[model samples]
Each structure stands twice: as structure tokens, then as C-alpha cells.
Target chain A: MGGKVTCTLGEVKNRADFIVYWGGNPAECHPRHFTKYTLMQKSPFLPRGRKDRTMVLVDIRETKSAKASNIFLQVRPGKDFELITLLRAMIKDQPISEAQVAETGLTIEQLQDFVSRMKAAKYGVFFFGMGLSMTRGKHMNSAALLTLAAEMNAFTKFVAMPMRGHGNVTGADVIMRWQTGYPFGISFNRGYPRYNPGEFSTVDVLVRGDTDCAFIIGADPGATMPQPAIDHLAKVPTIVLDPHVTHTSKLARVHITTAPAGISAPGTAYRMDEIPLPLRPALKSPYPSDEEVVRRIKEALLEKPDWMGERPQMLQNQI
Target chain B: MDLKVIDHATCTFCGCVCDDIQLHADDERIHQAKKACVLGKAWFLNHTAERKYPDALIDGKEATVDEAIAAAAEHLYQADMPLVYGMSNTTCEAQRECVEMADHLGGLLDSHTSL
Candidate 1:
């Protein structure tokens, strides 16, 4: 269940029949996405592009993408899992209770239509965001979506991917997976990758006051994280690397200024659509790049062999 | 000694991060950029506006870069617990340094959500 595989967005596009944008507004967040890659872009199989593909937008509000979508399912706030379950029932041709429809604020007709579209599609893809993962459900919401996708595969092809916001968040996940066999919420305290979201995740670690040291990369939880996480962050030994001063930088113990990604540093960032794009530095900065720092840490880890170890069996056992 | 032109680069102003761009430079200054969106254009043309020198607050006063770095290092070394944040706008290189320092000091670190 835990392994690494390399594939292209083109392959995913070829296999997908329906693309569902859930809890993410690609239009506002990724302006050129539809024009460059997802819907309107020209592809070998989808010669007609947007016309040849089915686009559905699932959000809490009616967004610009929803306005342009062929199907828009506006689920109530924090009701994503419930809606997914109801849709699952619909896919199975089972009757859904009116109470479930009322709870989700989606009419029976709307639910029926969404389920019909999902069933009719030859292949389907769900691109979800933090809106679903950061809310009441967190990882369980992701698990539910993945489970739904897995179930859908019995009738038609379906897959799900998180709409990672950072430029290299996917890269971080990829790196961690390659090195530790876990994506995130990784622990080195026991000398291996110990995967526990609530226990080892950045927020959990900070909230519980379990960590004494924190090394942050291309991410900022100060401005975005919940108040509890922020409060916890205020009490930690923090180091910041950024071009501009931010809330986190203001609280940093050691602030190292550097150039912006894709502007002053060259690296690879996974786009919202899970496409790997090269970031080219247009200018130079006095400080080193994140890659250099990670390389140094890796060298240090190599020198201190005890700090690095084989993947812990606990994660597999939990699974 | 002479000016140079580069092609196929990404713009860093906004989330778009448009990669198709050309840069024209002469000696020490970038004269013009082509095929850049409005945000990218402003970013390239206003390169001089970007800050190079670093400053620090010593007793709530602006101090030299060295003073700031020293103060920051001292603060980190002395603090029982600290939080390091913001890397969305910076290069990964700086992020690496910040991360190392956090690990050494056992601090909390994070970056911008939009970057």
C-alpha cells in the first residue's frame, strides 16, 4: 500500500472520464489551469478539448468555475462526507432518505443528477482541497473520498488527488515517501517514519507541545493555521526562511532571507492539477536555496547514521 | 561587459507563475521583459524596488544586518521554545537554512499557504 510510482498528468487525463473539482476553486486559485492543462487545453485523445470532457464543480458556494461548469453540486458546509456517502448510495441505485438530502441542503433531484453523471462517466477523478481536509473531518474526509473512488472503480475508473496549495507540497510528500515511506506526519524521534496525523502532524505536534525543534520549508502555518496551532507555534523554537516578513517571520527565532521560488531559485513544484513544473530563478539571492539546505541536512543525516533508519513496521500494522 | 537576453522563464509575482517569458538585460539592469502578464511585468520592471540590505530591531530600533543576525542567533539560542514561519515567498535554499536552525533549536516552522 505504501510505495512510489512515477506517472504523468497526461496519463491521468487519458484514463479519466469525469473530473470533479471538490472544495477547490481552480479558476480563482489556478487561473491558467483550465486554459493550459485541464479542460480547454488541447490533447491527443480529447481533440475537442473542453467540449470532449465532462467537468463538474462541487463546492460550498457557487464559484466562477461552478458558473461555467456543466454540473455544479453545492453541498452545505462540513457536509462533504455525508454527500459522498449519499452519492455512493445513489450509485448503488439505493434510495436516499429525505433527511440526508435536507442535511446536505441538496435537493433529491440534484443528488440524483450528480450520481447519474458519476455513473455515466467512463472514468472519473476527484480533486479535493484543504477545505475538506482542514475542516471537521480532516483525514477521514480524504479517506472517505478515496474510499468512494475505490468503490466507483468497480463500475468505472475513478481516482482522487488532493489539491495541494504549496508549489512543492507534493514534492515534500514525494520526498518524504521516498525517504521514509510515509507522506507526512512523519516522526524521527523513534528513528524511523512513524505516521500519525493527529500525533505527528505539524498542527498536532505544535498543539500538543510535543516538539521542541521545528524546521520549516516552503510553508507558512502562522497566517493560515487555526488559533490553537498559532498559539502553540508562538511557544516553539522557530526558524523562518522567506523573502518578505510574515506573521511567522515576525515570531521567528532565526530568520533567513532568501529569494522567491521560480523567481530567485530554480526547483520543481507540483501544480494544483498534480503537474510537475520546473521553477526557474529569474534573479539571484545572497542566501542559499531550500534544496541546498535539505542537501546539507541529508549529508548530516548520513554522517549521523543513527538519525536515519528503516521504515517502522508500526505504520503498516496500523494500516 | 555586454547585455544578454534569456528566454523561457517563469514569473514570480502571483499564483499564476507564468513560465513563458523573455528577459532583456544590459549590464546591471533589466531593461525589458516580453510575454509577461501585468503582474509579471511590474515584478520585472520594479526589480530595483526590492530590498537587498537586511535590518534588525535592537531595543526596538533599526540596526545593521550583522547586528540583526547576531541578535536573532542569540534569541534563538536562548529561547526555550520558538516558532519559525514564512517561506512561501522565499527560495527553497533559504527554507533549508531556516529548517536546519529550527531543528537545531527545536522550534516550530511553517510557510505561506498561497505560495
Candidate 2:
């Protein structure tokens, strides 16, 4: 994620002249993203601020995010690949068949205008969302977006990044990378690190019935995971560590309540753009902090080093 | 005491971590979260919201943190195959501890943050 993510939220907020909200409804999902970072911002580089910058909203529907755009490109759903490819081709002065142009629902002139605007900007930032990642072409759609950005580089400076959500989700990825040398789905089960995303990922592993028992910390998988995964979590003996009462905890063998990190415990959390910021504790919490509970668990485990050997059948406890 | 404004207060609610928040705190309770979005307001005010607190539980019975942890450790250690999942909302230090624990237990580790 670090290697791929090129620009910071600050950079996007201040420097970008041609901003694109592609397949992402920042108005709804991010709320403050457009207002604080992209459009409507009175940036230093943009002396006239919102007037100095131009935004393009490219989505399948007429989203609220589109209302803020100078030009809204409502490409057909799942036609992102086609639209992006056409933009890239048009940038390179390649001619396309009229039939192919008709399939995209965008006239060649509109695409050429979009490309020319992109080429003319001093600095551009392309912000994409789950619409691009979770769509039909998936990574290919992302590749096309990236390629378009790269092509724009010949005419002007440009960078693209996913409009990541869930706050510290970016933090989780950063910490995981520094710790395991992998972004996600890492296992040290064989006493060595193994990295595999689809195989070792939580839902995949749970759905495959590979995990026998689970210790869930700070998340509610039962409510959010796929049905099979939820069923597995419920059936198997599990532990949930959270401050809030969640669907997963309700079905757990042991529910250890912990204080919310930023609100009740002092810690460092990352912003959406991977900026590490100190999280100040605003209130006193009755529940133990995650750090304390985990330390206690480690202490308990150290005290019972041979416990696993004593009950070797625990490994085979799962069906 | 009168309502006081604490400027440069970071609202940990949303990822923005808007440090510009001026928390109006009366005592330790928040009176209002100024310079915040609705999401940030709800999150900051959530601290004062009434809620139940259960220290720990083991097998549907209330227990001390020690008792529950012991049970949990025992259950985890005995499992031939186990999973250590979800560290999204936790501190990096805590997440490191979890990774170490997972390695020691010879179990797998994953997160809710992983999509």
C-alpha cells in the first residue's frame, strides 16, 4: 500500500489543480474528504481556491459527489475499464472503432476534452473508491486508472490513490507491513512467516473451516463477515475483545471487554492517507485497555508454557 | 465549573483526526464538540453516553479479568489449530503483542481491517 500510495491527503488538499473523484462518493462516504482535502478547499497553491481547481466526478450514477464536479462523467456501471482505456488511448492519439466508442456511451469528443483537461493541469490527483476495486474488472480497473495517471504525466504531474475508508484501516496496513513485511494475510504458524492474501485472509480461512479456534480482538466479525464465516465463529469456541457489545461477542466462549483506544486509552492511530497521529484519551474507562489484557494473556501463557502439550487434542478439537 | 473549551483537541472518532476540535468539557464530561462533523460529534459525545460495563466473562458467566484470561489462554493453548484475528481498532503496540502471542501459540493471525 505504501509503495502504491503516492500522495498524502495534505498534498491532495493543497497542490492538486485537476482533482478526480472516480467511482468514489466522497460527499457521502468520507464526508469531510472533499470539503477538507479536495474541492471547496482554499489551498495555498490554489490562490483563488475552489475557483482555481477543477474537479471531475466519474461514476456510474448521478451521485452527490458528482454535484461538486466541473465535469461529471457518468460512465456505465462496470464500464470503467472501457472508459479508462479509451481515455488512455485518446491521450496517446490512438484511433478507436466507432462501434467501440458507441459501447462506452461517451462521445469521442467528450473523452478528448477530459483528456485535454487532464493534460493541461499543473498537478492532478485521482481518487478512486470501492466502486473501482469491487467492480467486474477489479485490479484491471485499477490498472487502467493508474495507466491513465501515468499517461497524464507526459503532459502534467499526476498521482492516484484509493479513497480508503474506516479511518485507521490505513494504519493497520502500515503497521502490518512494517511488522510482517507484507501488507495483509501473514501467518507465522510454521515458526516462519508465510504471506498469502486469498488463502490466509480471515474470511477465506474461516469459510474453508481451517481455523479451529479463534481469538478476535477489537472487531465484530459475526455481523460483518460472510455467512459461512459467521457460522464458523459461532460454532467454534471463540474469544472477542472489544469495548462495545457486538454480534461476534454475543456468540463467543469468552468476551473480554476492553477500552476503546483513542477515546479511553492513549495510542497512535493512522489517518486515511497513512499519517500517524497521537490519539488523545478524552475520558476515563472502567474496562481494561487492550494493551493490559493482552499483556496479562501473555503472562498467563508464559506461566503455562507446557499447557498446549498437556492437551494436545485441543489441536484436533475442530471437526 | 463553567463549560471550558479545549482547543487542539483531536477527535479520534473519524480518521480525519481533526486536531482543531474545541472540546467543551464540563468536568470530565463533554458538553459539546465544536469544529466537528456530525460523525465526529457523535463519536466524541459517545463518551458521555450511558452504557453497561462488564469487566470480563467466561462461558457466559461473569468473571475477573484474570479468570477469563486464564480460561482463554488454556483454551487457546490447547487448540491444535487456532486463529488470532482482528487488531484494527487496537494500538500498534498491542497488535505487536498479539503477533508475538500468535507465533508462540503456533496459530494464524489476521485482522478485521483486511478486506
Candidate 3:
């Protein structure tokens, strides 16, 4: 969970056997994700990649991925826990009651089928999105998925990664993790990294009106947050980095223009599948990249020690 | 009708904001779209969805973009507190503009979570 590893998309293609898309619609969000890296593309080992590999889609709706999946499991909204539990039960070969099956809207047979497929895969990768981690169950959903993947390892190989949307969101998470032992939902006020998802999560923090100053980088929250959160954001001191006039840009205070990664600035980004790729900027823009802004922030923090606090060596290592 | 081709157009449909789409136009009509998804195709092809362009309204009657921008700016500026919102559906450039306005006006800015 806390280490630096570098690999190319070609390597990922060579290693992966099963690709699971959890709570993501690559077709709708990342139109070229599949064409460039995953499903439809040809890989080194998997010359007939789409045919050689198993593609699983786990979402609430019958999405485009589901329509094209070798295995599509539709979980009821906010009922991911029940579905995970059912999968766990099936993995254990324990008898599942009809009532439990009905609760998940999935028959025991279907659950067993999924469990068997998951268990049999040579290498399974679960790519979950905010849909699984930011909803009613929140982190619990992620925890369950991680736990299931951990459980699966008893029989085979498995890994889980979040399908971060912002071009540099995974980069942000990596930076935060490297700096503070925590990914998102972090607080620098206390001078150390504190991991409290619900308490420190962006939504809860804004909705609770806890943060007075916010530095928003490549990401925008104003247009994507709930009304309550948005209402709260309108009152805080915010720093924005973007290139155009957006709902969030309209609200920013110190707006620092930045070029879009992959289009205007070259950088590394983790695809929705957790495979890191080098983004080749197709065009140039006048703005700087978020990386530069963050580097400046780091310099500023170094100048003002009060902005950050002392931490244990173990915690520092974790970060 | 004469035909024209446009390259590197942005899709105004989803948050993906797929900007590499190409459009074939015949007069005022868009004949076809390429490099877009099902949702994007529908959005670009269909022009009869009540027309959410030019003038927008908060409650009924039409209002100019200037009026809306001013009203929104005043409402945000005047508030002892204000929340600057919505970013997932627009381009990253627009998001930057929003963040600057928020900071300048001392407001909170958050992205709307559609997921």
C-alpha cells in the first residue's frame, strides 16, 4: 500500500489476466480508455487480448462495459456490502439462504459463478471508482473490495486500485500519500497525517464548514459537489488552478491557470485500471502544470514550517 | 446544401468533455459525428431538447448571460459566505476560472459529484 513501483502499460498487458471495472463507465467518462489500453487493444502476450482476457463489469447499472463484458454483475445501489458478503459466502462454499440472495438481487448461483471466476483468474485487477467509495457506504465499500481481493489471494493473485478521474488525481493521491501517509480525507491542520475518511473527506469537510482555506489544483469540486457542499464552498478562501471559466473557476479567488495534462502538459497518470502511463501533450497552452503549482506549494511549506508538522519516522515512511 | 467539416470539437454532453470529436455539417444541421460515444452523439445530433443555449433562466423567463453572470457574481460577492460550485461537466479551463473567482471573492468551491 505504501511503496513506489514503476511499470509501463505494455507490462500491465503482459501481467493481467482478468480486468474488473467496478463502478466505472469508461465509455462515458474515458471514451478511449478501452481502445488505448484495456479491452479492444492488442497486448504483447495477449495478441488476441479481448479474447484471451476476462473482462468483468461491476456496477449498479447495466452500463456500456456491462453490455460488452464477459461477466457483468449488477449490484443494487448502495447494496454493495450485501453483494460483497454474498460473494464472500460463495467463495467459502457456504450455503446461501434465498432471503440473502433476494436481498442482493442476485441469485446464489450467480454469486457462485462470479466467485468461481474470480478465484480461477490467473491475475485479477479490481478497478473501483468514486461510485463505490463516495456513496452511502463510502470507504466501507472500498474496504470490502480490498478484503475480498485479499481473500481471493489465498487461491490466486489479485489487486485493487481506484479509478481516479482527474488526470492528476492519482498523482495527487500519490503526492499526498508520499507526504502524509494518507490518501485524501487528510488534514494538515494538526501538523500530522490523520486518516479519517468521513471526517476529512472533501465533501464532509466542506459540508461541515470546517476548512477555511482550500487550494484546488487540477480538480474542481464546485460543479461536482452537492448543493450543501457547494453552498459551503462559496464561503471559503479558495485557490484554483485551471485554464477556462467554469462553475468552480467563477468562484475561485487566486485562480492560477494551468494546462490540461495529456493535452497541454506531459506527465504520468494512472489510468482507471491503475496502470501508469506517460501522457503526451497533443497541444500547448500558456498556463503552467499543476505539478509546478504543487512544487511551489511544497517550497512555500518548506519556508513556513508551521504549515506542516513533525511526524514519527514510521509515519513519514508510510507517506 | 453545402457541406463543411469541423475538427477537434468538444462534446458538451458528459463530464468526459471528449474534445477530439469531428462533425460533418450541412447548412445549419450537423449531419454526423465521429469519435464520440452514444450519449455524446445524441447530444450533438439532437437540437430539439428545449434548447439550453444563449439565454438561460433561474425560474421561467429568459435572462442574458451578462445578467446571469452579474446576478451570480453579485449574489456570491455580497454574501458574508458563498459556495462556488459545479465543475465535472465543464472543461478544466472553465474550472480554473471558477477557482480564481472563488478565491478572489473568498468563497468555497467544490465539484458536483454525479457518481
Locate the minimum summed-lDDT window of 10 residues in model 2 chain A. Answer: A310-319
Q: Compared with the true structure, what per-residue lDDT tens digits does model 3 show for residues A1-319?
A: 4432223344446766688888888766766656655577666667787887888888889977677678887777888887887777678777778897888676767777778788888877777777788777876787888888777778888777665564434443444444455545544333344566566567777778876655555556777678987776566656455544447656654454455554445555443333344443333445455555434433333343221234322232322
Error at A145, model 2, angstroms = 2.7
DockQ for candidate 3, C-alpha atoms: 0.06
In candidate 2, the residue pairs with backbone N, CA or C atoms under 3 Å apart (3 or more residues apart, or in different chains) clash, namely A314-B79, A314-B80, A315-B80
DockQ for all models: 0.21, 0.51, 0.06
Of the two candidates 1 and 2, the one with more favorable TM-score, higher being better, is 2
Count of clashes, each model: 26, 3, 51
What i-RMS does each candidate reach, in Å?
Answer: 5.8, 3.8, 10.2
Q: What is the per-residue lDDT of model 2 for residues A253-314, given as tens digits with 9 covering 90 to 100? A: 99988878876677777776777887766666778889788878877877875533443222
Candidate 1: global Cα-lDDT? 0.60
Per-residue lDDT of model 1, residues A1-319, tens digit only: 2321222445555555578888888776655555654677656777777787788888899988886578888889999989888887878888878998899988998887777778888767887777777677866787788888878877877777666554555544443454446555544444233566555556666777775544454556678778887776666656554555557666655555545566556776544333545765555555555555444443443343232235333222321
In angstroms, the error of model 2 at B73 is: 2.0
Residue-level lDDT for A303 in candidate 1: 46
Per-candidate TM-scores read 0.77, 0.90, 0.66
| Model 3 chain A poorest ten-residue lDDT run | A305-314
lDDT of 1 at A121: 82
Whose DockQ is greatest here? Answer: 2
In candidate 2 the C-alpha lDDT for residue B14 amounts to 52
